[model samples]
Each structure stands twice: as structure tokens, then as C-alpha cells.
Target chain A: MPTIRVSANGEAALETRDVRVRYGNNEAIKGITMEIPRKRVVALIGPSGCGKSTLLRCFNRMNDLVPSAAVTGEVLFHGENLYADHVDPVEVRRRIGMVFQKPNPFPKSIYDNVAFGPRLYGRPPDLDDIVERSLRQAALWDEVKDRMNDNALGLSGGQQQRLCIARALAVTPEILLMDEPASALDPIASAKIEELIQQLVEHYTIVIVTHNMQQAARVSHYTAYLYIGELIEYDDTNTIFTAPHEKHTEDYVTGRFG
Target chain B: MSPADSARASRHFDQELQELRELLLRMASRAEEQVRNALAAVKQRDAQAAQRSIDRDGEIDALELEIEERTINLLARRQPMAGDLRTLVMTLKISTDIERVGDHAVNIAQCAKRLAEALPVPDVGDLDRMAEVSTGMLRDAIAAFIDRDAELARDVCQRDDQVDRYNDSVFRGMLSEMTRYPGAIVAALQMMLVARNLERIADLATNLGEDVIYIVEARTVKHHAGEVVSDVETEGEFDQ
Candidate 1:
């Protein structure tokens, strides 16, 4: 009966209330309340400086790493406030993983890359199983199972991106935030990342920020359209793409302007 | 060469477009009025007037075909998008419905001609009401298309059920009258056919109304049951 009930999963995988992020001289994100269900992909789309990326970073306190960044909001996961007084920012990040706009695989072997996160936090008795499962979940196990010992830097850009996803999954985060994860790759590789994000929705709540409106339409079940640091409209992907209610939203989706 | 001359040139182009729209409106209104007058002739049992109505329906047919050709040419030449596409599509659909309206008018006129020889004129109050409502539906539906009014289009769709109800009553009345008087069978059958034809005209008007809605809202309410009322968010986590 709640106004924004997303699933019967007994808990919202991620929920934000009055979330705002500010820089020293200007505000990057205005107040935004959004709910993403467990195991679903929600795409955030807008023009440059629309604060989609700023809002994406708020999920795991990535904004905190910024020197002048200030945040005032409640971002909850599984009914508990992530920024509560006693919650560790480091532990919060481990629970909610992130991928960047460009692939940032560490300078290490592919095997060591996927194994790094699990090696850091996973139970030692199950390390090998964890690494294999994570790589397979990222859809990279078959390609890299033979070259597990090869350097990640030698992998193609797309492969390296998937390796980064494997690295994130290795830690087994409940939520994965990807900031334009396919912007650097070719269309084919971008499509692969999109397909992997869709597949990942079975086990992890995924939030994506992208300038590609069609990509957002293809990958997300729900879409939030932002403009000028404000959430203009949020609706099912099909409705937003084909029959948006707001004129502004329609103009943006139809390529009237950025 | 002068600033005033340049202003006059821009005004000429604007006037040309306005005149184009005016011509299209004249065509649409002519087709709409023919539908109303043809139905009126049938309900009044005025064979002379019905013949006149039927004869005039050729103009509507000619206009419908002309409009369709214009719409096709507009697509080829202008390649319109967005609202222009909607307007062009509405014109195409409205003209087809207008053609069907003309056909129904011809049917009613033929029925009036046959009934004049066979029977004393029967009271056709319900038939008159059906014609009135149906003609109004057509008029309003065309107006909606011209104005791009979604609300008026929806109202026309709702009014069709009323017209249909009157048509059914006319059919039932004629059926019982024929049963009561064996000699009246031929005339009653003609009336029945006329009523069915008018019902068909109303149905075409409904089609135009629904098409207008599609042009405006991009939603097909036809064959769609009930009102779509709410948006419910499913369980999920969205990072705001």
C-alpha cells in the first residue's frame, strides 16, 4: 500500500529519501527520492551536468571521497540507513560495489584481478569457488578461464571492463552502481555490457548512469529522467520512451535537446 | 529591395499556408455536412430530399479521394514528423470514414425511394434521433481532428453507444411491425436496411473519433477495455 512499493521482496534493495549532494560553490544534485527494487536495473539519463553521475555516486558514499563534497540525505539498504552514525563507510562500499565510466582494471593478472576482492574479504576456505562464480556471473569465465594467469592489462577494452565487473562481483556486493560502463567501448562491446547488466539484475540491484537514451531504454525496467539537477520524471521504461507524460521529458527523449 | 517588400514576401508565404488549411477545412466540413443531410432525408421519408442527398454524396466521395491523394503527396514532398505526421494521418483516416458515411447516405436514399411506393409513412422518431446523434458525432469527430482535441475525440467515441442504442430500437420496432402486418413486410424490410445502414455510419464516425485520439495521444483506446488508471511501482532498489 506504500506509494512507492517496488517489490514483494520484503525490503527495498536501495531507497533514497530527500537525497542532496552539494559542492562548495554549487549544488550537483537536488533532493531526490527514488526506490530501486532488488535485482532490477534502473537507468538514470540526462544531459551533461544533470547530476545523474553525482546521484549515482551517492549510493555507496563515493561522494565522500571528494574534498569539497557535502551530502545530506538518507540512503537506506535493506531497511537500515547506510550513513547512520555507527555504519562504516568502508563496509558500506564493500556491500555496494561500483564500476566507472571507463574500465579501471588493476595492473595485475586476470586471475589476481577477479580474485582480489574475494581475497580481501571473502572467507578463505571458499576463495577459489568465489573467484570462479564471480567471473562466470560477469559472463567472462569462459573467455578468461584459460588465460586466468595473464595480465588484465593485455585484455581488450571490453574484456577489461568485464574483468572489472568480475572484480566487483568477486566481493559479492548486494548492489552494483555502474557509471556509463560502456561509454568507451565499441557498439558490440557496449551491447555486451548492456546484456551483462540485464543478466546481473537476477542477483544484484543495478543502477546505471548513461547519456545513451536508447541504451537506457534497452537495459532498464524503470527509468528516471533528470534535467538541471532535478528529477523531472520517473516511470516504466516503455512509457518513458514512447509516451512520456511531461513535455520536457518527451523533448529530451525525442532528441530535441540534451 | 526595401524592408517593407521583404515583409510582404514573408506574409505571402504565411497566407499561402493558411489558405491551404482553409481548403482542407472546407473539404472536411463538406463531407461532414453531407453525412448529416443524407441521414435527415431518410428519417423524414422525403423521397425528393433523399434523392437530392444521395445525388450530392458524390461530392463527398470526390473530396475523400482528393484528400487521400493530398495526404500521400504531403508525405512524399514534406516528409512531416511529430504533429505534422499526426495531422496528415488524421486527414487520411477521416476521409475514409467520410467515404463510408457517403455510402450509408446512398443506402438510406434507396430505402426511402422504395418505402414511398409501398406504405403510409411510419412514425420514425427514434430513427430521426439516431440520425441526429450520428450526424452530430461525425461533425464533432471531424472538428476534433481539425482542432487536435483529444478530449472531444474521446467524447465522440462515448456518444457512439447512444447512437447505436437508437439504431437497435429502430430495428426492433420495424421487426415487430412487420410481424403484425403481413402486407407491411416489404416496406418494413427496407426500413430495417436503412436503420442498419445508419448504424454503420455511426460506427464509422466512431472509428474516426478513435483515430483522432490515436493521432493526438498515440494511445489506441479501441478494443481496449476499461480505463487505464494507475501506475504501481514494483519492489526494487533505485539509487536516487
Candidate 2:
């Protein structure tokens, strides 16, 4: 399969060329080729078991830990293939961070959670400034500044998710991959996370996997619809929501079917 | 089976959508009736019948308001997408077009009342023909909307040129009659106003047809229908 470059300006932050993932005898992701533009949020949406998350994990090489899982094809970050022999998985993960579905903050204090990633790199000279800046970038600074010493688990589900975002930001990753980050929160908290996503695009490229069509429409600049491990359509969010070219995408987004 | 064949999982959402469709059809029916009554009043030269047509426009106005309120409620509550979203947005626009059609009907009825009071009734056969074509377009445009037939909608758009030609001929004939008979100026001018109203009604019907095409095909046919290779040349012909 040929690489599909969706962006016209040749400024893709990440590009996947005919990538597929297989676990033992079962193929979870068929071949998909796409480009994620710099500083723009790209949303991958589909029904459950459509391999959206599996495709996301390929970005940071999180699938390397699975014993039977195998990823094939090229995943390029800044013109360099990530699956090359010499690249370190730990360094790749630090540069391309992830926030999972549920907020899994460590049992340490709020200050410690935000400082965790930076500490892994042997402690920067401006560690306090880095922690405060990451928290502010995640939009959780004012709420957690007074309780920096408090345990992260003591915070609300929404606050804890923001802390996780802050932890990811502390590493100063060039790209952020979020997997259903707001699904576990209430309406107000979900709206706050959405607002944070809109702001974060100014600093980091984002690729999000979401089942909520409305959330995908609201947060992402570009949207790709996946079905049965294949990419059905990918276009600007306004075009996808208003006048998608494919019938399957239209049916899925309109609540007619999955 | 296609995905659209699968019913929306939310039963209440389906109910609300059906209700909106029914109300819009009802309003279309009422507007069509007003045009027929106004044309009938002109044929009979009865001021009382014209007054009746003018008075019924209030009902169309009220229906427009009701449809507006219901559309806003659905948008806020249901948050529809794709086809449902297009349907809701098109409903709001089509209702406005139907309301304006009602207003044009009222204007024609008022012209009928004025012509009834004049000294001599002028020859209005051309005006009658204009009304016939305009009303047929309106009725068929509404039918196209009901059936979601883009072909029928395109046919309706093509018929608009015939109405415009009729309007031009009526204006020229009225001017010639005024020159021949000075005492009949008032009645001739009233007939001219009637011709103009019919022309506007035809334009509104074309608008309705274009909207139906939008809802069905998700492509805009407005302001560029001429480029679509129709039998009629609709470019730079009318201000619309």
C-alpha cells in the first residue's frame, strides 16, 4: 500500500505507511497509511474492537511489551523510522508520551507525580519551574498549587486526569497520544479536558482515540473513521460531520449504526 | 442492509424528528391553499374572497413560529448528526421560504381587492397563466421535498424560467394597454402588481426545490444551478 499523505504542506509531525498490527494468528489492524499534521489534533474514531487503540500504541511502541504482538511497516517521526534497530524504546516513549483511558496517577504527592518524568532524566536544574510549567500547561496549576504535597489519588477523577496530562507534559514530548482521556469524567470535567485539548494544540501535536462522535467533532481538526480495522474516511472535522464522502462514515456519525 | 435502515437507537429522538417533518408538511399544505384561494379570488373579481385569503395568512405566520421553536428545541436536546442534522437545518430554511410564499399570496389578494374597485376590469389572461404555472411549481416543489426526489426538484428549478418570461410579457402587455386606454391605468397597474407577485412565488418555489436537493445530495445547487447543465439557461436571467 502507498503512503497516504493527507497534509498538503509536507509538515507532518508523524507519518505511518501501510502499518498493520497482528497478535499471534489474529490481525487487529489492517494496513493503514496516514499523516498527522504538526500542532493539530487528529482523532481516530470507530466502534469498539476496531483497532483504534492498537494503532495509537504503535506511535510510542507500547506494543513492544506484548509477547505475541507484532507491528509491521514504517512509523516515521520527523523523517526517522521508530522501529529501527538502534532506537531505544524508553527514549521513544519519553519523546512521544501517552495518557490512558482511566486516570492512573501514582500514589505519590501531586508535586511528585508532575515531577516524575523529569526526574527520570536525572533531575534538571529548574525542576520546580518545570513542574509548575507542566501543571499550568495542563490547566491544573491553580487548583493543585496549594495541595502540591497531597497524594494524587486524593484528587477528583477529573483532577487526577489533568495531573496525568501534566506528568506527560513534564517530559516535553513533541507529540501527545491520548486514549479516551475524558471518557471516565463527568460532563463538566469532560468539557474542561476538551478546552485543555484546544489550548494544548499550540504546543504539541495530538492524536486522540475517542468513541464519542461529538467529542471527536468538537476537539479535533482532522477526523479519521475506522471500521473493521480499515480506514473508511479521513478529512477535516467540519467536512466529516457535515458532509462525509463515504456512506459508512455517514451512517456511523449520524447514530444510524456503529 | 444499509446502516440508515437501522433505526436510531433512541426512540424519543425518532419521534421528535417525525413530529418536525409532519409540522413542516402541514405548513406547506397551508401555504399552497392560500395561493389557490388568492388566485380564485382574482378570477371571480370578488373583494370578499380576496379579503378571506388575506386573513388566513395569520395562520401561516403562527405555524412558522411554532416550527422555529421546535427546531431550536431539537438542536439543543438531540444534537443530531449527518442526515438528521441536515434535515433539521433544512426544515428551518424551508419553513421560512413557505412563510414568504404566504406573504406573496397575501400581496396578490390585496391586488385582487384593488382591481375589484377599479372602473373597468383589464384583460388578465396572462396574469392567470402566470398564476397557474407558479402554483404548479409550488405544489410540485413540496411534493419533491416529500419524496426526496432530486430529479423532480431539478425539474421544478428548470420551470422557473417560464414564469419569468410570462412576467416580462405581462408587464409589456400592461404598458401597451395603459397607452391605448388612459382611463384603465389603475386596473392595469393592479394587474401588473399581481404578475409581479406570481413571479416572486415562482422564485420561492425554486428556492424550495434547491433546498430539497441540498438535503438529499448534500450538495449545494444554489447560485450555481446554471453550471449543472440543465435544459434551461438560468444564468444572469433573474436577480435570484
Candidate 3:
């Protein structure tokens, strides 16, 4: 295994050293080393089952919930090894939050949903202020500020996703991991999410996994191309979209491959 | 094939790209021929041949419009990236350049027709050489574009200085002829106009060359010629 090149500048908020993930007999992620820059959006893109999602999961110890799954190698957060003994996985997840492929908002009111994480974890003082600030950070405050008591499920698909983002923000994470955040929404809604991602990146480091290369090009500052569980290429978004070094990456981005 | 490659390759978009390339090549070939014939018309002082160049300008204009429409259609619909995106954008820009090249040919033809109608001046041999070099530059630039040859495009850019030198020589020669022979003044000025048009043609060809370099190498060598340094090119770490 070799050190994967991360060409972009700035200190890496999250770093992976030869990280590999395996589920039972199947090796899903090969040894991959990456330096994800702080306060920047890095998008992981590849074809289905290429380990983009698996690698993204490793950033926050999301793979720990799976049985028979083993992740070797170190995932470091700002120079601290996350896999060290006594480092709680729950705390790791709380610090590094995730938004899934679909908008999985709770059945409760929008305000309650944003407050849920805080109440369960630290029960931060001034719960109302926290909820308001989270909603504002997620760009959902103006739309649902009056309807804070409304059920989150009653909101539009795009709004529900934003509410989910607000919920994720309620915990006040340092880094945000989004897996196909806008894949389930309409083009207009997807554009909104993309805009939100751009703004939120100023406050938190973001790592997104996306199948849409154009969206990756649009929203991310950096892009990583993965193929068959192996890290193929990682570079700035402009380079990956315009002139990728790897033949596999070129083929994938140009629609020469699936 | 890899499993993903075997899945679905979007063959329709690939075919569209192929068709667009061919159409742009055809347009370039037509423009190139018009340039050659128009320069020949100037050397021969043949109004009939000059008229042919004038007649074809509308066709080139229509072709330009068609290429623009198709390019916009592909960009809006396919949402291309990487090499495909560069190709389509350069096609749109190169077509505009070629169409303007066509217009320059027409301007040369107009001068040729006026020179044919006026009293004759001594032929300036350098204008013929300048015509040959500029037309050849146009041909090679289009060739580099269609073939995706960045080096060939750079060669075209390097030749622009030569055309500029010939233009300077042609201007001095025509000015001397105008000063010497009072009766040949009108024809000398027409010849000068023809030389000016040829020089502009060379500049457009240089534009085509710079665009081809972008299409082929993903490099912007527009104002600065030779080696273009970008973030991707300078970052040695990502070379692996």
C-alpha cells in the first residue's frame, strides 16, 4: 500500500492512513490514504459498489454498526487516531454527523426534531436558541420559522432534507458527511441543497459521496475518484472534471464508462 | 470490460459527440477552401472567382448557426464533463473563429474585385507568400482541432509572428508603389486591404490553435503561448 496523493492545499481536518474495509470475506475498500482539508467540501465519486460510500463511512466510524465488518488502518481526526482504545464511537459520530440518501426526519414537529439530538446527548442550555440557530444554519429557518410546530413529515421533500440537516447541526458537529444528499430531490430542490452545502462548508468540513459527477463538480472544492474499492485519483474539482490523470477517472467522468 | 463499463456507456451522447466533431470538421474544410480560392482570386485578379467566395459566406453563416444550436443542445441536455465538455465548447468557439475566417476571405475577395477593376500596379510577390502562409496556418489549425493535436496547434501559434512580418513587408512595398506610380494608387490600396484581410485570417487561425490546445490538453494558452502552468500541471503530488 502507498500513500494516496491529496493535491489540494490547507491542513487536513480528517486524515486516513491506508484505511481498508472488509465485510466477512469481501474486501470493499482497499488501502486508501487521503487528507481531507478542513472547512472544504470533498466529494467521493465512483460507480456502484466501488467503495466510495464505504470509504465515506470510515470517516465517522459508521461501519462499526455492521456485524462481520472489519475496518483496518487509522482514521485520524486532526492528528488524533480515532480507532485508539477508549475513544467512544458514539462521541465520534456526534462530532462527525451524517445526512443519508433519503430525508429521514422524525415524525415529531420540526422544532422537536432539531432539539432531539441535544436533549439526548448534552442537553445544551437554551434549547430554543440552539434549534433556531441550527435551522438558520441549514437554511430552513425562514421557510419553517412560523411552522416550527408543524410535523416534519408534512414538509416538502427538500424541506424535510434541510430539517434533517438542521437536526444534524443541533449536535454542533465539526464535520458533515452527506451521502447523496440531493439524489432524491427534484432539480430545483437539489440546487437548493447544493447551495446550502456551499454555505455550510464555511463553518464545517464536509465530505460528500455522490453518483452525479456534475453535482460533485458543482458543489465540491475537491473530488476523489474510487474504482473497485481502490482510490484511483484525488485532486481539485476543476482538474477532476476537466483533466483527470487516471484513464479510469477520465472514462467515468466522460460517460465512457457507467 | 469492468462491470461499470459493461453496465451502460451512454452511447447516444458519444454518438452525438462524434457527429458534432464531424460537422465542425466539414465546416472548417469549407472555410479553408474558400480562403485558398479567395487568395488565388487576388493573385489572378479574377472577379468571377472572388464572387464565388462572396456567395459562400452565407452558407458558412448558416453552418455556424447550426453548430451553435447543436452545441447548446448537447451542453444543456447531456451536461458533459472532462474531455467531452472541452470538445463541445471548443467546437462552438472554433466554429465562430472559422466563420469569421470566412468573412475575412470575403473581405479579401472584395479587394481582389476592386483591384481587377482599377489600373494595375506591379505585383507584390511577398503578398502571395503571406497569403500562402496564412491560408496554410488556417488549414493546420483546423487539422489540429479535429485531430486533437496540441503540439500542432502550438506550431500554428508560433507561425503567427512570421505572418505579421510578411504583413509589415507587404505594407512597405505597397506604400512605395503608391508613392511611385500615381495612376496605380487605387490598385495599391486594394492590395494593401487584401494583405490586411490575410493578416486577420492568420490571427483567427491562431485563436483556433489556442482553443485546440485547450480541447486537447485541458490547458489555457490563450494570451500566454508555449507552456501553460496551471494548478493541475504544477502539482507534482497528484501525478501518481
Query: Which model scores highest in TM-score?
Result: 2
Q: Model 1 residue A79 lDDT?
A: 84
What residue runs in model 3 are displaced by over 4 Å at the alpha carbon? Answer: A1-10, A147-150, B1-9, B226-240
Span of ten consecutive residues with least summed lDDT in model 3 chain A: A1-10
Order by TM-score, highest first? 2, 3, 1
TM-scores for every candidate against the unseen true structure: 0.71, 0.93, 0.92
lDDT of 1 by residue, A1-258 (tens): 112223425556888888888899788888888888788888998877889999998899999899899988899887888878998988888889999988999999998898887677755777778888988998989998898889899999999999999999988799999999999999999999999998999889899999887789889988888887788888777767766767777656644442
Q: Give the per-residue lDDT of model 1 (tens digit) for B1-240.
A: 233543465355335434445655676677666666655565565788878877887787777777777678765754443344555776777677777777777887888777777774354437777777877887887788778788988888777667666766877777777777767888887876776776677677778888778778978777653442111121011101
Per-residue C-alpha lDDT of model 2 across residues A1-258, encoded as one tens digit per residue: 221226737888999988899999888889888889999999999877889999999999999988899999899998999999999999999999999989999999999999999999989999999999999999999999998999999999999999999999999999999999999999999999999999999999999999888999999999988887888888888878888878888878877663
* Between candidates 2 and 3, the TM-score winner: 2
Colliding pairs, model 2: none
Model 2 stretches with alpha carbons more than 4 Å out: A1-5, B1-12, B228-240
Fnat across every predicted model, in order: 0.03, 0.56, 0.83
